[model samples]
Target: MTANRRPVIVGVDGSPAGLGAVRWAADEAVRHGKPLRITHALGVPGPFEQPFEQVVDEHDIALDAATEARGWYPGLHITTSTWHGSPAHVLVEESRHASLVVVGSRRTGGFRSLLVGSVGLQLAARAYCPVLIVHNAERWAAPESPLPRQPIVVGFDGSAHSDFAVGLAFSEAATRGVELVAVRAWREQARRWGRGADLTRLAAAVRDALAADLEPWQAKYPTVPVGLRAVRGTAAPVLLAEGSDALMVVLGPRGRGGLDDVRLGSVTQQVLDHASIPVLIAQHA
Candidate 1:
């Protein structure tokens, strides 16, 4: 993998959130024996707005992130790139063949604007590689401490891509000595008679079916703390609500159901919206 692609890619905006992304990218780059490349997009100014200094500022931030990464890992190579386009478009385009793309959610606008800003949301949905959205510092980190331990929550629906997500989640859990939580969600099912779907039972049955698929993995990783939860509700909301303190979040490239599944099961899409955390998206589903 090292020989075939860019080592690590992170977006920088100089905000605390962006710096947090740089921090995580540096750690991964150092641990994997890979270089760190930082990129920032020179966003076009809104109509009639030609902020020439914006480009220079964006460049400076990218370079700053590169310097920070190199400082963390002296042996870790560093490269920087600047593109004149939409941030999300440029980042996702560059992420096509890179190891991973990391970004931070900093609201240039208001509160709701931060949830899934333009660049972060687009990358989360369209990036060809994994997109990590850095939010807080474990909700409990020193001013200059290494990242803290948190559960690695993986979203699954039984497809091959979902399988890859599970494997990635397990690998991360094993590597980090952290807990792993796997959650599967389904639409509430209707009961007999002229009744609507039982959302509660639907969540349970879906959870049970998904739990069964995890049996072999459970046997193989007996010592790794694992929990399976099948919940009733939308996947994005459930995962988002539960992953607040999670070390990282992962999603299958698609879903298990089919066209409808992929279209609807895109918690990854919604997860990136205004979310603050690291996310991994497998290529298969």
Candidate 2:
């Protein structure tokens, strides 16, 4: 791997989800023509002291993941590293120099009800680079033949954070030669003085605002076809449904309606927790 080029990093922990992340990351590295870096975290010691053999077993796990990735992309440049720290910390640090960090929606958990794993949640909120969470790699597996281009969905709320998300989404769509769908979801508030007509007018205003916000990005990526969707509903459900067939869903850490004190916005949290497709959280450059 070249020293200057930023590799796409993926965390592996020998779980089914970890394998899914590996496959998705390998495809991304190939699509972007970048190097692939597979990482496994040998977490800090806790109450239970691990035997020497167990530590060696961890190394074996990482090695197996690297081997599997190589099988998928024989010509791609692949590198593997093991970090001695928490998975979240190690991956977050790796994100500092990575073009993108791809991970599974959830890892091995005792409870089957756990939707998104803790490591994924931490990285979504704190990663330095864009974090891509692949929920179902099997459904998103790379096709052997060239398939029709899928659109990239971006949840736009006309906020500063959405600005970054728009930029990233446009770039990805342009690179992949795919369509970009910029969505803005709104909800009508009950008014004491007005009737149902007032709510309809408000919805129209939100739609117009969404179109205006997306105009600049459309102009910037003229080669990339753009689709503007403004609907009356919650942002999370709208984005989730739109992203069902998209290549990936892009969102900001916060939206226009996000609380200032919260690290992760409500819309982002909901999508990250429930979206079945890959979700990309766009952070500041």
TM-score of each: 0.76, 0.84
Best by TM-score: 2
- Please state the error at residue 35 of candidate 2 in Å: 1.9
Write model 1 residue lDDT over 234-274, tens digit each, in one string: 87888887787788788876666646334324566677653
Query: What lDDT score is found at residue 128 in candidate 1?
Result: 71
Give per-residue CA lDDT, model 2, range 93-122, as digits (tens).
999889899887653454321124677788
Q: What is the C-alpha lDDT of each candidate?
A: 0.69, 0.80
